[model samples]
Target chain A: MSGPARTPAEPATAPALEARELEVRFPAGRGRWARAVDGVSLAVRPGQVVALVGESGCGKSTLARALLGLQPVHAGQVLVDGAPLAASRAGLKAYRRRAQLVLQDPMGSLNPRMSVYESVAEGLRIHGVGDEERRVAEALGRVGLRPPERFFARYPHELSGGQRQRVVIAGALVLEPSILVADEPVSSLDASVRGEILALLLRLREELGLSLLVVTHDLGLAWNIADRIAVMYLGRIIEEGSTDEVLGEPKHPYTRALLSVVPEVGRLEPVVLTGEPPDPAAIPAGCRFHPRCPLLRSGLPDEVVTRCHGRALPVLPVQGPHRAACHATDRASADS
Target chain B: MGPGARYALRSVASGLGTLLFVVVFNFFLFRMLPGDPIGLYTRGRNVPPEQIEALRAELDRPLLEQFVTYLANPFASTINSARYNQPVWTLIGDRVWATLLLVGTAIVLASILGTWIGIRAGWRRGERFDRVSTGVTLTLYSMPEFWLGMILLITFGVGVGFVPGVFPIGGIITPGVDPTSLAGVLDVMWHMVLPVTTLMVVYLAEYALVMRASLIDELGEDYLTVARAKGLMDKVVRRRHAVPNALLPTVTLILLNLGFVVSGAITVETVFSWPGLGLLSYDALRGPDIALLQAIFLLFSIGVIVANIIADLLYAVLDPRVRA
Candidate 1:
């Protein structure tokens, strides 16, 4: 597939997009709030692909929205090119032109009434960019819709799932954004088309040098395309690192439980934790993952076990090449 | 044939079938009534035997023969009214313009005002303007059209105290003005003020409520969120994306209402004493005027059928999915 030849080591250049300590809360009917996304700090370096992976309701999608500036964050700043994102209308409009979002469901994302040309030209028209016809044609060509005029007047329902996703990507690419935030880009397509769409995204990144922040629950997708992977649980990043480091040597119990089920060759017996998935509204005390942590049940030392049930771990540092938020990892590092 | 042409052909063919059915129904509807047409026409006057014989000859023909003749030319001028003793179409033609002028004005005004209000109310639901406007429209919608008409007639036609009655009390025009002059046109519009307002209020409330509900449904659609993310202005997103899609269902409603323009607002026209087809129907019911009633009923049915056809074609034009 000719994937980008990038190293896992931290790059010296500034990030194309960065979110620092971002928190998004929604009202839970009473005085309490559900912390959908809490204190998430992540960055995508120039020409890098970072995948945010987690199970459903783990706040991964919420975190993606916050990074795109589509969802209002209750706390923390979203920095673009090392400058805090502007709150003004003109600034946000300009920011959107530089960073576009590719939504999960292409069928629902494109207006059914609008034709392909109109949908792709919408961003340019909004910004009053001239030469709409040529630009729209170029963007369509870039997304593999060859001889774009053949599809210009077509509606969303006329195209297959993969084609619709391509049109959505074309709509975003027409703005010439440097960064693309794709939330479950291929999850809604058929299994046969998923690989094709993923390959197209990778090709776009290579051809345009565009940084990508892909959000998905599939660890295999991360292994295939992402250089870095961030694992979230109950609205917090429990572990993150290079895909090789994290997948080969998972530190947190949550990450280990997740990777155990990835359907790999000669994989270990799956670890099935016996508890309901964590709830963001009622996160457990001590460690949020302690309720489902297999290590807690595996008979750790008394002192370490006591700390696991009573103390909350601090947030991971923003500049780590590989990091995990777990007490056992901390004690093991101390011993080493 | 292309899908567009096929759809249009199907719509028109169905409309014609419905019209033929209505035509047959109209012929038999009065014949099946209990009263004798000759007896009803000659209740008080002492008539000669020969004249009575002639009346019976005209109406009491064999059922199959009468049906064939009626179907041959439904609007034949020879078909005279039993009550007015004039040709039925002449009577209808005189009142058709007045009814069209009054109802046409009301529908146009109501659709525009109601749709605009509905779009705003639905887009900002649960807010102050939405709550207040929704309540007002619901109240108007539930109120009876006749009662509302009478209230308007009394309040504006016959002023109570210091508020003087400015508009004409009744009739389509004032007496002794050149009927074809510009003054006569203004007078007719002035007379239409009360009846038109009454119909507009009731119809506007309905349009607004339907439009509001439809728009609220469209608000949650993912396409609107996508448009907002595209960095379009909020107003552009609403007008260009949300409203056009929402207007699809409303187009059917508006065209269906247009079909009733021929029937006119019966209660509103009667209460205001405007000389439209509605009032003519009300007056004709006094004698149970069979010929006039038949023609008017047929016209009403034709109006609705044609309207349904237009709605189908227009819907296809507005929504491409329907074409497929």
Candidate 2:
């Protein structure tokens, strides 16, 4: 029923998408790379919702673009179904059909000049799909735009903000892609409308067995819908695990600080990190987060503090499926 | 009335108001010009005393009476043109077709070629083709039309004599060819080549530059990225999604340029010695032919008003945002 049974010997099921040491760099100066998406690796499994969470300028958006093959990668690779994606035009086009993107702003993501039907049917037309009338209608209905014919002739300006976003989602869903990389899907929406769109996404996931790679800066959004959470910091994932495991017990300093900020009555006072994150153009020599690491400021042995400045963080599995990349976490666990 | 009809009615009403304003303003504008039409026409001529008195009696009416006559029977032969010895409308009617043919062909050729190049250049921005095409169009846009026409005139008409002085240096057709014969049509087009090229290049630049800038802005919009992710072929994404939005402002520009075409390219027509409204206006100005000047102004105002109405209607059709 779950397709062919995945054998343990086959490395379990192939991830819907996986990035291995993917690096995307922009030229900062003559012969110098800005390192927008520093050597980073993450994966999305079948029928799973993985949230890549990071503040603005943390390279989360750049990483998302690279995973879609929309932007060129300076180093490393992105694989779909465990096979590396080819850079050829036809190969990329085919890959795009399997993994679609929903942008943040619905108003900006839909062409003002096109009718609702044309916007949704555009993908089908481009891919030469047959029975476009039924498919476009079905896609719109799937996004909660009921009786899609009523909306077919309407233009973008005629719709409400929520409806516009639904049209944007309908445009993506028309492709029937396996993976949807939604970049801040609800951030531009009204607070009341945001929940509806999120609910629609979850419903589509349950019905179609669609996998999603949601990128957002809101920890609350990750808590609301994500099956797995990957906390990104300065172009790398510092912590990752099941939502319950990671949120319940965040190991990395950044993750812990992030969770502390989630508003709850009688919750612990948050650990407020001082200063902005270090600039990517001039990352610190070791433990990129060490410059703002609260643990460093809490007082430690001079030798350990020196090590935080001298040694780079490594990704390490801890309990069950949870993973973190911090030298202090490693040292503490070893001591215990 | 529905809001759409009300909007269209409102637009047309405003257009008519603008034409009325132009009529009154143009009458006074020509009236304010120094020198009398008869005096300017009769300069250095030995006229009989009785003939001069007869000319003065016909021409020296008060300003208000003259304006009333102009409004009452605008196309009538009431306003005598000392230069042409006929009604002002007759003089303009003879020249209007030549100007329309020249300007219409130039407008059509330039709009098609410029918009096509712009779509390609904007789609592949920063590529070699985009940079070079943009550079070439901008250079042509900045050139003086008269100078460019003169250069072509010199090169083909006199310098190289490639056709061995065969290209008519002046007028729309050969002096002796049967006006209705095949030779007449060919000769007219042969003369058209140089002046037409000068106008096409200048006008083509405006369309190409506007389309390129607009398309570049549209390309940055998020919809295009969504289209790309929808697995659309690159060209399909551009043709179906990008070009429609970019074409909006360019369409408005084309209509506005078309309106001015009735005024003719005064300098280019002058340099080519082509018989069009522009050359006629130039000669009228030299003679201070107030009657002919007033008629030409009225024709220009009507062209502009008609074009404005068409632009408004087309914009409503193209962009639903403007429909209501």
Candidate 3:
């Protein structure tokens, strides 16, 4: 057969979920707001898996929330299928049905008092979906829970960590959302179970053509399953590209520092970033990541160092499917 | 037996043992209190030597023998009230149902209203309704029961000359009224309003506060975020996901409150002069009536222990994790 033809109703090339110049802020105190997610833009294409990698407070999760319309965006818009998200009640509800969220802790994410069936069927019941029984069972089956009846009556605590996470996924799948935004989904699971969950996500994307936006702090997770990677530092995406391109040849200094610490089997020289990420409320001027950038301290040319310390960096295009927001990289490319 | 069954059985056995200790302790402690029941019964007037001798013989038995006899036939009306010239159990039996009715009604009302308020307050935390309700309930909770009862009694019972009183000042019903008739029933309930209101106001805050605190804790849980992410309306998230989990700890609190129902609220009952166990205990304290006091203590302790056992069983049923 030839390549799949686009349906007339929905443009095939449209992204499943997209965010443009998204910003999320929380009131810090004393009339000051801390920007959790600063002017950022991203997109999850139909049937592709994108991993959003960052440190603990880097706002990858915030961006994920914004994508699902769970968080109120302070600035910019989140688009679904190339259309601006509607702010009306009915419109928001319809949008929510197209996007769903999976949280970090499986143990804490499922109501311990509710049975697996109740948990899985909750979303279906909320959106007033019909044929709930078959839908719930089918969702569970797709999540690798065979004969879902065995788990129908069991509470969350009765299940293992892996099974609980599968139930959480089943809860998400029951809605049949096109985009599944998972925030550190496997961070709370065992190492053995983490692979199984990641594989399940990959398998779901393949079978259902579902778009996935996975937010995580683990570089290894991005390498394992992501088709593309976006590295966020202090609420900004510093690097974006295909997984192999970005991980193999990191153009952004923050991305390089992050990848340097991912314990490789044979690599000896590991670059360790000194100092913590600056407080978001008091983010350093110029590049937000310049405070901890190792390249800035490597005795670069005086002009390059001044630019790094004083000027804002734009996401400059590198070789195919790769971009980074760093002045040092620009200078290096110019010199070469 | 399974471990859960064994655990339940063990709890029951321990509860029964505690009840037994309370019984012995109550019996002995009352006997040791200063005051002679016989003297109180006779009103310090001259009494025939034979009658005095008989009263002493009935009450002055060796503590060990009395306890053993009580153990052998605990339900028998062996203990007599010092002032009433009747069995202590019989007198308590008359008042126990009334006490239960008043306190039971209060507890039921408090739980339903309190839990509802808590759910609302916690779900929309920091809203005006939450702030106002929390403040009002806390103020009501802090007021003394007797003081609150007196205030209700005065305002509703002894209104200003222009505005007449709406409720009775005290008593369970009008004196010498036929209790079975509709008019009598109305009278009893009318009198019940002040005392019940006092108890309800105080207890309502407890439940509301506990439920609010517990529900607030549950609301912060990750499950609730997942529930919201499921596209559920705010109310649905709270009722389906948050309430059940929050209600777990509150269950134990509610059951314990039910247990306290048997004893009745002494201060409120006294302020109303309601013929309940609390009033009976209060009077018996003045007479230093050992038999009556001991009987009331026993009933109160039994209520507490039984309620606790029921709570434990319900907890296991509600939370599967506790079954282990």
Candidate 4:
């Protein structure tokens, strides 16, 4: 039940995985491009859990894929241990061995035809690692599938939803990767089983010093597990900081709107902003969130309001412990 | 009993029931043709009045008695053919091996070639090779089988300017070759080249198109993406993860196609004049040879039913989900 040790402001260890100004674009039919993941930078320190929280279509999953090198990067760099990711095939294979991805929808993720043993042993076979039997058995045991031999011949369809997700986790963990990029790892599971899978992930971090980059839209999940939180809007991180700082005192109106919906004891009424979700293809001019900003309607000062409607915001600065990109927040901070 | 065994037992029982139904149906089908069997059997033959009376006495029995004799031994009970005066079973036996050789070889070759083309085309979908192969196969698939056969017959069987007739125009083998010797076997295969090619072209198109479509569906499955993310090579992901799953539907189609091999391609056989069951059936229809038609119908039904049973059992082995 106890939390892991707090991450130091200046940790001696380098980030296990980091994305520096990553951008990913997809062709939107006729000549136009959809900036799916546009100009986002974030880092996951070794053994630290960082949650990327955002609504659907905010490019959180695309950013996760870009970090894993599964999606081609349009711009910026992905670093591992303070060095940029290697470019050669052999280097990519080696990088993949050190980092792995656990996808959402375990029912769809695991191959129905493959037995549990073969599925877990896949990475080992790919990398040509020896002692496969013992490694696969150990990975299964780590995921809490007791007496791994019992599960060796079992298929994905034969297992329960939670058990299937565990098998997927076992498949990823079999490689002994230093970091795991889990994309909504439990979003498709039943409500009762979500906590167990999240706890298993946290336990793996403690036992193996494995860094995790968990992507989800559930603020409750981030509050329960993540050491830090990054809230994204329209393919950009609008607010990011230690979980306590960002959740306790959210600065951006979008973050506040998201937090307002999480049911808690004696909290203010939820902020229901009236606007369609931002479209990545045609992001509005000025601040992308301006069209939907509750504060703009709540009556900000004239000059700050003008900036919100006329000027685009820059990416979050690297120096601050907590940072938010909003003209209203800048004005409030300046006044205080 | 295990689910697999139970499934096999059920499939085989149903197949046998269908065969029994075909047996009873074949006997009555020809009798209802509104022509006298004696007249059909004795056409153009000079015979004494007493002998004709005797033949009628034997053939014109009560329907129940005839059915009993048929049920006793369906194959041997058939009347001698009016053309060759040989028992229908013996005539059928003579042609069985020839037909099997032609159809079996075509099926095997087509399956291998078509499945390979399908895998490559589907894996690199939308590429130039995929587009060309898919378009070609689809066009071939839509062509009439008999039309394609005739085209091959004219082009390869008969000589054109500067291109000598490379293969024999018709028949299974040359007249002078020793039937048991290596030369004879070679001659038979050489003669088979045209007819087999004709069958293969039509069949290959079917397998390739089905396999291509099946694999395209499997390509969008999540397991393939997971396989790629495991650091496996691209080819490995396709061969190990995608193709095995994709082959499920294609396997069913291939096995069902095998069921029709015994029937033989009637039009193709007639065009080539290959001495197979198909040619026998064609000759029988001209005589309206009631007895021979009945026996051939029964044989074709048996072949198809047995194949359906095999397909069901093999499917259980190939896809574990079917076992349960």
Candidate 1 scores an fnat of 0.55
Deviation from native of the Cα of residue B123 in model 3, angstroms:
1.1
Write model 2 residue lDDT over B1-324, tens digit each, in one string: 887898899889999899878878887887777767667656676768888788688667787987887677655655567678678887888899999989999999999999998988988898999999999999999999999988888877776744555456768887888868888888889989988988999999999999999999998899988888877777877888789999999999999988988899999999999899999889887777777777887888899889989999889888888985
Q: Candidate 1 chain B, which ten residues in sequence have the lowest lDDT sum?
A: B76-85
What shift in Å separates residue A36 of candidate 1 from its native position after superposition? 2.3
Q: How far does residue B153 in candidate 3 sit from its true spot (Å)? A: 2.9
Question: What does DockQ come to for candidate 2?
Answer: 0.66
- Tens-digit lDDT track for model 3 on B81-171? 7768689888998999889989999999988988888878877899998999899988998898899888888888888667678888888
After superposing candidate 3 on the true structure, give the runs of residues whose Cα lies further than 4 Å from its correct spot: A1-12, A265-268, A315-320, A331-336, B1-14, B31-46, B58-63, B160-165
Task: Name the top DockQ candidate.
Answer: 3
DockQ scores for all the models shown? 0.58, 0.66, 0.69, 0.54
Pitting candidate 2 against candidate 4, the one with the higher lDDT is 4
Q: Which residue pairs clash in candidate 3? A: none
Model 1, residue pairs in steric clash: none
- A1-336: candidate 2 lDDT, tens digit per residue: 111122121136778898888889988886777888888888888787888998888899999999999888999889998899978888998888889899999889999988999999888887788999999999989898889999999999999989999999898889899999999999998999998999888888888888899999988888888878888888878887777767777788888787788773126468898876667787787777888888788986887777778877754331126767777765542232
Looking at model 2, how many pairs of residues clash? 0
The worst-scoring run of ten residues by lDDT in candidate 3 chain B lies at: B71-80
Identify the leading candidate in terms of lDDT: 1
